[model samples]
Target chain A: MKSTLIIVALLLMLGGCKSTGGPTLYQQLDGKAGIERLIDSFINQIARDEKIIHYFEDANITHFRDGFINHLCALTDGPCEYIGDDMVAIHTGMNINETDFNHVVELLINAMNELNINHTVQNKVLAKMAPLRAEIIEI
Target chain B: MSMLKFFLGFIACLLPFSNFAGQGKLLATPGVSQVEGSAGGGLVPWAQLAGYATDDEFAINGFCSRADVSDYTLDVCGAQINLFNRVEFSYAEQHFDVPALNTKIEQSITGAKIRLYGDIVYSQWPQLSLGVQHKSLRDGAVATLVGAEKTSGTDIYLAASKLHLGALAGYNWFWNMTTRYSEANQLGLLGYGGANSRQKLLFEGSTAIFLSRDIAVGIEYRQKSNNLGLGEEDWRDVFVAWMPNKYVSVTAAWLDLGSIAGADDQTGWYLSVTGYW
Candidate 1:
C-alpha cells in the first residue's frame, strides 16, 4: 500500500511536468497575426501609461513596433529572426530605473489582459522578458 | 492581554488606508502569508516580503489559516506590514485544539524580517533576508505539563529565494531555502525545548512552478527537531495558490505533519485566505 501511494504521488508530479510537451509557445500564441495584435495592444497601452510614456517620446512608433514584434517572435521560437539592435545597445542610454522597468511590465500585463491572453501564456512571455531588466535598467 | 495587543496593532495598521494601498510589479512573486504569519508557503517562510509594496511604497496584508488534521485542529490569524519594500513586521495568534483531550493551547507570535540584499526577480543573486519570531504561550500550564521547557522563545532564521524566469520551457520557477535555529516543537504551540533542550539547526525548502501569472503549485518540506520527544516529525505539503488579483489570494494544501503528541500520521487539509492592500 505504501509503495502504491508513492507511485501515485510520483504520477501526479510527472503530470505537472508535462507542460513542456505541448505545442511551441509561438504556435500556441497563434503565430504571426496573434503576435502582431499582442504587440499592437501592448504599444497602445504603453502610450497611454504616463509612468513610462515619456521614455517613448522620441521613439519612432512604426519602427519600434516592427522591431518589438520581430524580437518577440524570435524569442518565442517563431520563424522570423529579429533584425533590430540588441536590447542592451538600444536601451543603454535610457536611464531606466527599477520603478520604470516595473511600470513597463505592468503596462505589458494590462495589454495581455486586454488581449484575453491566457495567464500561462502571459507568464511565459514575461518570463522571457524578465532577464532583460539587467540589460535595460541603467540607473 | 497579548492577544488584545496584537489585535490593536492589527487595527492600527489597517487604519492607515492611504499608506497601505497600491500594487507592486510582477505576479505571484511576493509570497502570500504562511501559517506562522510570515510571507511564504503554508508551512515554511520564504525570503520574499509580503504585500504589494514597490520601491517607495508601503503595504499591508492580513491572513487567516485553518488546518484540520486527524488528531487536532489548528487556526492562525495575523497581519503584516511591509515598509519601503525592505522590512516586514507581523503578528499572529495561534490556537491548537485537541478534541480528544478536550484541551486547547494558544500562542502569540511577533515576527520581523529584513531584506538584506538582492531583488526577487531583478537580481542574479538570490534575495536574502533575516527573520526573527518571538513566541509566547498563553496556555502556560498546559504547555508545561506536556514537558515543554519554556513558555516563551525566539526563533531566528535566514532565508534566500530566487526566481528563474524561462527556466522550464518558458515557465517561471521559484526556489527558496531557509535555515532556522530554534527549539520550538510544533512551531511553539507546544512550547519550546523539553527533554532535548538544546537548540538545533533545521532546514526548510520550497520550489514552485508558475502555472500562470497568478497561479502557482508547489511543494514544501520542513525539517523539525524532536526536542520534546513526543514523536515530532518533519512537515511536508503540496500546495496550490491562486491570486485572483493583488487584493485577494487563497491557498489549499494537503499536509502531512508526521506526528504530534504521539498521534502518528497527522495528515490533513490546510486552507488559507489572504487580503492585501
Candidate 2:
C-alpha cells in the first residue's frame, strides 16, 4: 500500500511538471479570452474617465480594441502577430502629454483591479507596457 | 505642536479647492516627506519631488514627525510645495529635547530641489536631482559649549532614484542613492563644524519593496560627518509606510542612530504623517 501511494504521488507530480515547464506571460494573462475581457474592461474605464475621454472621442472603438488586443498578445509572447501601425506612427498626431499618458495607465490599472488580476501579474503586464511610453508620448 | 496643527489645518482647508491637485502622478509615487522636509524615506532624501504634481500641475504638502530615543526626543514639522513636478521648496522647524540637560534645542531648515533628468518609473534611467538645504540654529549655547565653529551651514546633495516593476519576487523594488557635502553636526542642531572645520562628502542610501499598491517596507542608511567628534555615529532605520491614497501617508520606523553627543546605543521609534493638497 505504501509503494502504491508513493507511485500515485509521483504521477501527480509528473502531471504538474508538464504545465510548469514554461508558462509564457501570455498564458499567465489567461490567453486570448482573458485578453479580450481585459480590453473590454479597459474600454469601459476609458469611456467613463472624463479626463482622457476627449482624446478618444474620434477613435474607432472596434479597430482600437482589436489592435490593442493583438499588441498586448504579441507583446506577451502569445501566438498572435500585431501587424498594425507602429506605436510612434499611431501616436504621432495625438500629442499626448505626460499627465494624460499617466492617467491612461492609471485607468488601465483600475480596470485590471476590477478584473481581479493579481498584483504580480498586473506588475508584469505594466512592465511589458511601460517601455512603450517613449514611443507613444509627446508625439 | 500648535504650529503643526496649523499646518495640518491649512492643508485641510485647501482640500476642497484642490480638485485638480494630485491627479498627475500615480498614487504613492511622490513618496513621504523626510525628516528634513524633502521627499524621501525617513532618513534619506530621494530624487523624486514632493507631492503628486506633474508637468502641468502644482501641489502642496504638510508633514510632521517625532522620534523618541532613550535619551532625547526630536520633533519636526514642515511644509513643501512642488511646482510643475520640476522643483520643490520646503521649510521645517526642529525641536530637540534633552531631559538630562533640562533644555531644548531648536533649528530651522530651508530646502530647495530641482529635478535634472528622467522619471522614477517610466524612464530608462534613474531620476536625478540636485538639492540644497540651509540650516539655522536658534539655540546656539549648546553648540558653543560643544566647541562647534558656527551656528549655521548649507548642505548640497545629488540624488538618484528608480523603481523596478516586478523585480523583487513579483513586487516592485525601489532604490535611491544620494551624496551630500556638508559640515553640519547632528544636522545643524548642535551647530556646524567642530574640531573638523571643513565639509565632508557623505553617502546615503534607501531601498524599499512595495508589498502592494498602498504599502512599502524599506531601510535607509545615512552617513554622518562627525565634525564635533562627540561620537556622532551614522544613522540607519527600518521603516514601513502606508499610503491608502494620495491624500495622506503614515510612516513608522525603528531607528538606530548609533551615538549622539557622547551617548551610545540610541535606538528609538519614529512616526510621521504627511498630508497632500
Which structure among the candidates has the greatest TM-score? Answer: 2
Q: Could you tally the backbone clashes for each prediction?
A: 0, 0
Please identify model 1 stretches exceeding 4 Å from their true place: A1-34, A73-100, A113-121, B1-20, B197-199
Q: Residue B214 of model 2: what lDDT?
A: 93
In candidate 2, position A4 carries an lDDT of: 29
Give the per-residue lDDT of model 2 (tens digit) for A1-139.
Answer: 2332354345334434423357877998899999999999999999998988998888899999999999999998899998877889888999898889988999999999999998988988898899999999888
Colliding residue pairs in candidate 2: none
Model 1: DockQ vs. true structure: 0.31
B1-277: candidate 1 lDDT, tens digit per residue: 4664666576576666855354764666788888888898898888899888866777788899999999999999998888877998888888899999898888888899999998888787999999998999887887688898899999999999988765554567777889999889889888888996654899888877787778888888888988888888889889999998888999999999999989999999999999887
Native contacts, share recovered per candidate: 0.35, 0.59
- RMSD value for candidate 1: 3.9
Worst 10 residues of 1 chain A by lDDT: A1-10
Q: At residue B249, what lDDT does model 1 achieve?
A: 92
Which pairs clash in the backbone of model 1? none
